[model samples]
Target: MSYQSIHIQIKEMIFSKDVSIVEFQFWLAEVETFLCQQQNFVLVVRSVAGTTFPQEYRQIQANWYKKNKANFFKYCVGLVRIALDQVDQERLNTPALHVAWQVPYYVTLDRADALQWAVQRWLLCNA
Candidate 1:
């Protein structure tokens, strides 16, 4: 399956896909560029694929964060995670929240919850 990335406005960004590491990195770079223009923005991520905790993937994320943490925190107001089920949600959210503790994170089982949480966060941050 293919991945999609769209900026709904200055308020939010959406990334939905079952992406490979390469695709994820490309999308991430695009998102980062968008975030750089904002004071704060809500980030919504929908992982349509099932969760798989590969060490390589985790390492890549960690390394990317290490290299870009300041820019990341400077613009990220909150995060919304959309997972297929409880197990996937927990598996993805746990580590992500650990790394991005400065931002509020909402984990949801469906797209509607994800969008609701993200919109609320965007409102709060912009307010």
Candidate 2:
């Protein structure tokens, strides 16, 4: 399934374009729905090299994550974020932000590394 700038696969979400607030909300809803199934999954978010969002979008995501913290902990094994652009790579490399996610979070410029990290987490969780 797919929203405006987000494409959803069984265990991955690809953000191929810059997302608007509406699109972000849609993606959030899809995530919430997925969590409702109560299954363990690794979420791999691949953002296009230059994709970015406004501060408001971050605020919305923060609020939603806060509200669903427990469900996320129970269902999400980890999160792997692939950001190819230098700016995005630096921004996502923060230790504090990684801790704030409350899940294993990894950021990398290489999609292969992201997938490998995600698969490792998935294996650990499902083991």
Candidate 3:
């Protein structure tokens, strides 16, 4: 699947809302350049919001993320403030560890905190 390139200025870490796998793929294609060129990254998902992806699809993507864990150095995660169903929370919580349970990483339930944490960490990483 192909998606129109989404342009986002990530000079400072910021929270991104739910995006599809193809859009995620497109975003990653963009992020790879940053990861290779910059210090680190912190990406946040506000919530599932909506999706056409099946459960298996998300699981597969999450699995790929888990396998490529080492590809990340500067990354963190934040969940949305909106309420989520049990299944959605489970899905988010599981892959979130790819961000949460790590060295020099953190998980914030609030978007503002997550962005602040990510920016601080990025500054520290560069310093």
Candidate 4:
């Protein structure tokens, strides 16, 4: 499934470029729908190079996670982010973001490493 800058394939979601608030909201809605399905799944987010979002995006995402904390903890096995650089990775791995994530969160500059970690987490959670 593809929506604007967001693309979903199997258990992974890729953000190929910057997105508008409308696109961000739509992606959040998709995430909410996915969580509602009550299936254990690893969420891998790939942020391609040069992709960035406004501060409003963070606030909106944090709010969404706060509202869905219970369902996230119940269904999301782990969260893996494939960042473009160390700065991007660090930004996502901060304490404030951790509070919203709650689940095991891993951030890396390597897409292969991110997918490997996500798959391991998913298998472990299911096992």
Candidate 5:
């Protein structure tokens, strides 16, 4: 399947679902490349119904990270969008990593009053 055709889930960052173990590794690898190639961006990933990495795909990622640590940046935002009918706990528990070369300075907009809380921060501060 074409990456262009794929739509990842996005709340803040964009994300996609992994249907299987092989697909899960492929997804991570692709995301890693996207972050390395892009200068500034946020990645959105929804934790799957199972522990994708820790239980199934972590070793693959570990090997990749071991060799390309410099090419990627790890940010643990600890963000989770929960749903009752869905959302697997084991999958959520699996460690999630967001790779980015740079982070942007921004303000938090209140969900109820977006503009009221929205304010842009200086990028220099982030750097």
Candidate 6:
């Protein structure tokens, strides 16, 4: 299936997809672009049940982040809102496990909870 990546005015980065390695790489670059421009924001990812990336894709991501970790550390705040369901515990943990970048990440079962958590984190930091 396809993916959707969108940047809202609130400075949150959101993406929903079931993509291949190549598509994931492209999507990640778009995320990097947003992080670079926004400088610091929360990320919201919506994933389907049973979705998992190949080990090779995970390796590629790890390598890319190893090269760009400093940039992410410099510009990003490191909070992730993952939207998934309890039925897919494995998929729910995939992002947190695969991410090479250092940041406080979280997973939620729904978009509303994810958004609320992200916003609360934002408010806590800004306050």
The best candidate by TM-score is 2
Which regions of candidate 3 deviate over 4 angstroms?
1-20, 51-56, 59-68, 74-103
> What would the TM-score be for candidate 3 when compared with the true structure?
0.51
Query: On a 0 to 100 scale, what is the lDDT of residue 24 in model 3?
Result: 52
Q: Among these predicted structures, which one has the highest lDDT? A: 2
Cα lDDT for residue 73, model 6? 70
- In what order do the candidates fall by TM-score, top score first? 2, 4, 1, 6, 3, 5
- Which ranges in model 6 have alpha carbons more than 4 Å from their true place? 1-18, 50-55, 81-83, 87-101
Better of 1 and 2 by lDDT: 2
TM-score of predicted structure 5 = 0.40
TM-score of each: 0.70, 0.80, 0.51, 0.77, 0.40, 0.65
Q: Which stretches of candidate 2 lie over 4 Å from their true place?
A: 1-10
Q: What is the C-alpha lDDT of each candidate?
A: 0.66, 0.79, 0.48, 0.78, 0.38, 0.62
lDDT of 3 at 39: 35
Mind giving the per-residue lDDT tens digits that candidate 4 earns over 34-123?
Answer: 688767777888866777776699899888988988998988878888777888888888888676678888888887898889878877
> How many collisions per candidate?
0, 0, 1, 0, 5, 0
State the lDDT of candidate 1 residue by residue for 20-121, as single tens digits.
678657756865774677556677776545433334676777777787778777777677767778887788678656566567777788777777877777
After best superposition, candidate 4 residue 120: deviation in angstroms? 0.9
Task: Please list the residue runs of candidate 1 whose C-alpha ends up more than 4 Å from where it truly belongs after superposition.
Answer: 1-18, 50-55, 93-100
lDDT string, candidate 2, 14-126, tens digits: 76567788888988888888688777778888866567775699789889998999999888888888876778888987989788888888888888888888878877776
Model 6 gets an lDDT of 0.62
Which of 2 and 3 is ahead in lDDT? 2
